[model samples]
Target: MKNLLFTVFTVAALFSACTNDADVKTFVNANGYTIYNDSLISFQKMIIEDGKVRQVGGEELSEMGEVIDVQGKTILPGLIDAHAHVMGLGFQELNINVAGIETLEATLDSIKAYAEANPELEWIQGRGWNQTLWPENEFPTAADLDKVVPDRPVWLTRVDGHAGWGNTKAMEMANISQDTPDPQGGKVIRDRTGKATGVFIDAAESYVTQHIPAPTAEERRLALEKALEKMASEGITSVHDAGIPAQTWELYKKFADEGNMITRIYAMIGGTGNDFDELSKNGPIKSYANDRLALRSVKISADGALGSRGAAMKEPYSDDPGNRGLLFYEQDELNEMVDKSVSNGYQTNIHAIGDRANDVVLNAFEQAIDEFGDQGLRHRIEHAQIVSLEDIPRFKELDLIASMQATHATSDMNMAEDRVGSERIKGGYAWQKFLDQGTVIANGSDFPVEHVNPFFGLYSSVTRQDHEGNPPNGWYPEERLSREETLRSFTLDAAFAAHQEDVLGSLEPGKWADFIIIDRDFFEVPAIEIWQTKVLETWVAGDKVYGNSD
Candidate 1:
């Protein structure tokens, strides 16, 4: 009798939902979990029309087209990763990934194996290598790589993508030698005799990359497609593709038109590219395939990564006192860059991982905002990872968003304290402090560097511990964000950072029906178990992108 009754109601709802609107869809009997006004709420039914959320949780909710019984599973706004390299993740799939390899021998063996299998390849290109995990905790030289692949150039980026390791073949091919002076804002990693050691930090990476053979347009397209599919399967509805070159912009447009863009992309123009002039003069491109693609932001790198010891610290590294790390641009240069970007109507996001870099960039933003009269522009500081106590409240004062990666704290737990010393470490990864001052934090995984799972980021943000539950009380436990705050960091807050909150983030009316269903309610789960939560379904624009064939 119960089965018969459900079947009859489903048919009636389906007929009613499918009335005038061909695209109208109704989801009923859902947990319909969502965050509104900083609190979690649940709705039992929702109506989607014209790819927008038409109504949410009303007893009189009229079904429009097709009706789906979510079976009371936990539903949430589709996850959006505020920081990631989408194209690079796809290429990582195509190349060698030595991400979690712990030992130097394992890394060399993997490179050798990859080269042996792909004899047709011109060069060996891959990422995710951290020398700090090695016994010596020192940078590897070309000689180390030459021991594995002397015949061809091997270029592997450090896990953070801020530094790179190359073999002798790569340096030689690029004409790097003892005479090659270090590029400004970059390091050549020279020996005592001043010979180039095939390790490039920050801006210096361009030297070898410029020499590398570019991926063919088809190869890039394939990579983008792979990334899009992977994101959908992972229950990600939107990805902020960190810094994309001009060539990729054309491909993004093509994919959006053809409806291959299962996941929406909010991109930032690469500052190093020459296409800035054309893009800046034309201002932002806000309406691409009804916001499936958006490019209104410019990405600027103020410094390098913490792991590489290339994040310009206010004081010299505790472990390596001689090194204070690299700063990409002087304040004057940064001020000019911010001025140009904001004046032409672009939101500027600078990568600042260290206290020194954050302070410098903040100063630059302050001066630029003053000069440009930025009206409600949410300029951003990406990876506002390590900051000083005095400069903490300035984020709120300046109305700047702290774009952070939650998993970074867990990943760097062991080394972060030793590198910065206990005093400075207090203000590092200070999520709670930022929140107390009413500063918005947009959280994500710097994927392909950390794991791509959004759950991992949420777990780290809420628990401040690694997967094993280390650091008894959590590393800087007071700095951890509550579960409520962390969810906002990933959802509504992330959308706000990309200037898409009105349509993309929440599961409320007038927003795109982009949401996911999970096996368990994140709020109901034990904090330690959050990372293990599985996504059952992902829907975008009222269409199921992953899971549930019906």
Candidate 2:
């Protein structure tokens, strides 16, 4: 009797769904394309039912639903950033940012202007200062910031977020002194006279940050909304936020519950803090609130970034001798973390920039998989930046995902070789090397570090050059990815990395009807003009989220 009732109920539900003509909509005159079974498939029209794709092909219009004409616009699957910081991107816009400033003097001028404008705040907080861009080509000291805003406690972070520059007043408030010892896995830059230089690297940043006030929930909410708006405008319908604290996790939940989320988020617990202990106990939130949000991964930092010379290399930096760089954890400690994450049903993604850090993370993942088994979770190494040639093949062998940033190569091209030298550069930012070995490379902007534009990544991936088109043929031209390979990295491959390919990556049948209408065909755009590609309309779940209405 129970089986009979269940069968009747299932049949009734199916009948009801099929009878709902109001739920069906057809989009016509679209030059639609999506990756299907590792191949690009094209279609002329798409039929959607109940926020899911029903079919996408050139069939005579027989369905009884509203027919909308897109006027032959190009449509592609929504771009997904495999690794990025949502809140960080939001705050980068909300705060007084100094990114793209050409010189130290100009940066100071901007800082001073911002301080004067916002004198009501107790601490002047800002970011996006890169000393490499300055004529000096050196790290900016607190002295540089002091010359601008001496009275206010100015705290500025470098573009990489691995280092912090604080005014003397800010350091004084933190009680940092010459006698203060550097924390393990971090460094406090000091002068020849043994005095604090007001620059803190990695773990040492806590000395000052601990004193800075945390943003209120309301502030975070605004920041998130701002980030979503930015992403929608850029055609990013989904983003895998690399790390989220408990507060961020809570905010994401709140947004999802309230139906306020415009872009899909795949969040990861920040393993560096106690958020893991509190958040990871429930296993993982595989999907939530109609798949607008998911919390199934944990982000762990293995080492700092290369720009700060804090990346853990097997050999000492070619420029900074006697410093191979700092590792945040020993082999045993990292193994335990990886094992804990995998055993708890979390996809573990570790940030590894230098060769030594890559080696250590690879070992940790191997041990964890051997002990706890991967559970087919597809562990990843974020920023697989300066890996050794020998360890390159391990990515494919371990069935791991290399979550990499393309613009990093173009942005770091000027100084990367100076840090690691000739031989190591061969393996550094080698996207083609990983692709050739059958290893999946998921692309991202690492936004707020690099620009949030996916086209910048696409352009950089193919040309291996900056916006001005440097190095002619390209930087290490042989290592560049083809256009198809680059798009796959940012789209379907990225979705695979986040374990959401079945639902989000492609605009195929049964998947969420998430796609974007572009101003021009991405495939037909010139390599140099790729970065300038404009998103005409962004749609999620068959609803237009961002676009100008005609």
Candidate 3:
């Protein structure tokens, strides 16, 4: 379920591009094109052989190979979601998607509907609920959910995935009560009466999720299948699987061995400190299934999310002045762990949100690099969402990657300034600032948090506005990236983050035969139409994997 191509050229219209006369498939007649090196290239034809790019030239080159027609669509490097959850996307489809619902009633209604439809489910699981979109912007209590599905456990993750709201039954199943102490780096929000509101934040969310039944292997395999299919349809050829448990990584390997792998995954072995320690001792898993999978990265979390009031902050919150946030580790502890991991050659990707978290992580990265020297593993700080103004350039100085999500900017614009205050907001979602300093900003949609659509990210990055073109101008117009810059971030720079730049990321010679054909010229189209540009065909390794099925 990777990308696919359509409108196959009649074999009679082509010849071999190379003298070797190997099995060659030629793609020609694109209305506009771009490759890794240039935003716009003069070439109109490309040749693929043995699942690798063989040649790219003008119409003359097209005459040498069996021409495959693109029907005058725009061709681009298959988009890579630099940071996304692979299986989370599939589960989003399998379970409830309460993503764009505008009101509280709609959220409860969705849960009720899903519960009614799947009565056999002991626990109704879903995500993408945000109180920020609600009328009062107040957290919903368990009583609100109890009004609907009170029989079974209901666990709904907040849109940011940093918090969870559960029904009374769910919390009871976990034995959470007013007396239950919040976990380190987490919270169990309470009301004026000090009753458990059934809202868990950051690490505190484990209280309920740990009790939820794990999906069966077959179920996981199916979710992955569904996930890859969804990814392919979106013109996503490859993704950096944000973090997954060992079982999930093994499941990915099983699929790769079965030759069922379509969407390429650069997996990060995910777990708690113990799991990470064990995995580190066992060491990284570099390549599997002909490089279709690479599990050589470790994911760590520095703090919670800003929306959940869990992200570690240097100062008190602007809106809630009395409350600062939680940090998962002390500076030295985090530094020691990161230093060892990088010294072991594993790409350490840390989830850092608040300025304090970013600052701490950045300092740790600098210390680790100083101690170990550069391993060129391109260690990344995921969701470098809100770096302090003083620490913005530290990303480039330390050679640490700011693996960010563009959609997060537009998604958070509504409540962000209110949370961080106007002065601190200057450093939040500062993409253009990073770019100007030559920091390779790897962009993505932290999928399952935002939409999986890369175009939405592209739209957000270029416009710094939500899909409806809100705020008249962008929320922070000065921070918007150029169209070419955003594309490069999603493609080449994304590959660079995964250490796959030489093999993927572009439609250049000697690279993987990965490219996507879209319905509209992304560059020439009006900015408003950018998100409307649909994937007409997606191809991986010269094989078509998706067409306009609908």
Candidate 4:
């Protein structure tokens, strides 16, 4: 009886040891305080089991097997860039970046130097030039580029990515002339002499653009991969690719299925006739590859950009009298597209910059909602840069998302005031006002238009300051958002915009283990220093996708 009792005791001890080991497999130390990673509602004590969050704080804590200390590092949800053009990055790097070039002479000089060095290339392509940044702020004549590249055709796009400035050679090659009437929804900037001045806005630029060589498929793939890597490194786990081609969407699907896709993509099909037709026929594709990719929206360009003076404003520009900007799409056509998209189960994301443009889009969306009866469609207004106070309420009433890029507010602050004057400034980039009314904002850096660094967007949203924090106080201080609001715009709200709130945008149990470790806690730091914060590590699904230490 004693020997039997001893054997039973030994077996019980062995079983208890196995149970402890099993518990160890599920432990994670959150270091006491509850983690409000993405949204405050998602606050929990995490149990990291097998590299993924297994359970939240509860009775589960005592049973949690082992604990791995996260120390005191504040872990937030992995960020999402709500609006960006990712494929454009590689092209921007390979071609000339002319967005911020201040002087026509300097722009020509840069092109001339580039042409001289890359004589083997077939054509010269560059983007990122803003005439507003120039001393004269006047459109440059084709004569300037002609003098530099008379032997070769040159095309450089303005900073807003809405217009193009071409040389005389390009105009001749495309058969553009004084007799060529402005295409519908476009303008060919001409001299008082009735000659083409090299600046083409909206649809007019496409005459030259359509002729330029499209990048090869391999080129597109490589550029996308490079852009994804950069996004992951910055702790951006997802992005709403603002205007993507159908072909690019195919590539995204291929990559996602193969597990090569590193970031969650909410792709808004570029509103080309082909893209609209294809997406409409098939209907919305929700959460491909376990909620990694989504395609349910169409992006429509309502008007051009403010920098190019093509943003259809309520009043004429403060600087350029008699010009209130131009609309890219006809009103009737826009309404039709919205109606068709809503009927076909597709959301519409319209880019509207100037006050007038914002009004136009808001009206269209209102009409759609009236007819369609708000089926929880999170329709979006991209940019919404300059708005009227009256139109602001419409965003909430219609349940439309304010898909804004915060960097645009700070970046354009210098010239925006000069363009719109004080009366209009109140409604421009009014983030705080929108939030007060219970509107969700999805923030991003319109990359290639601005830098893709999410920190810059966060900094600008919180402080309304430029990188250097000049001018003593921030720009439009009343419009600035708090740190929490800014973070939510990049994470939780952004996820909600993309219809991905369930699986991502929060570091909660059973959700994908996606989070970023920043060098400093944004909440604790001085507002200005937020711009200087660096991403320490980026994780996706419990795997380290990018890390400085790794």
lDDT scores of the candidates, listed in order: 0.85, 0.88, 0.84, 0.79
When summed lDDT is taken over every stretch of 10 residues in candidate 4, the lowest stretch is 3-12
lDDT of 1 by residue, 1-550 (tens): 1111111111123223346566877787776666665556667778888787777764466755778878878788999899999998989878889897888889999999999999988899999998878787788889999999999999999999988999999988888977777787888888898888778998889989999999998899888888888888788899887888888888999999999889999999888347777555677987689889999999999998888888999889998889999998888988888888888888889999999999999998899878878677799999998999999988988999999999999999879998999999988999989989999899888888888889999999988998888887889899898777887889999999999988878877678999998888777777889999888888899888889534
Question: Residue 22's C-alpha lDDT in candidate 1?
Answer: 69
lDDT score, candidate 3: 0.84
Better of 3 and 4 by TM-score: 3
> Which segments of model 3 are wrong by more than 4 Å?
1-22, 271-274, 277-282
Per-candidate TM equals 0.94, 0.95, 0.94, 0.89
- Count of clashes, each model: 5, 0, 10, 6
What is the C-alpha lDDT profile of model 4 across 1-550, one tens digit per residue? 1111111000011122224444333323332222244334322245444445555553234444654445455456788999998788657866777666778789888999999999987788888887777888788878888888888789988767888888888888899977989887789988789888888998899889888888888878788888888889888888888878778888899999889888888899898478778755767898788777899888988888887788899899998899988986667778988888788888889999999889889888888888988888799999989999999999998888999999998889878988888989889999988889998998998887888789999999988887778656888698888777787788878888888877777655557877777777677678888888888778777666887843
TM-score of 4: 0.89
* Candidate order (lDDT): 2, 1, 3, 4
Off by over 4 Å in 4: 1-52, 56-74, 99-106
Instruction: Give per-residue lDDT, candidate 1, residue 249.
Output: 87
Off by over 4 Å in 1: 1-22, 58-64, 548-550
Write the residue-wise lDDT of candidate 3 on 375-397 in tens digits. Answer: 78899999998889999988989
Candidate ordering by TM-score (highest first): 2, 3, 1, 4
The numbered model that scores best in TM-score is: 2
Q: Higher-TM-score candidate among 1 and 3? A: 3
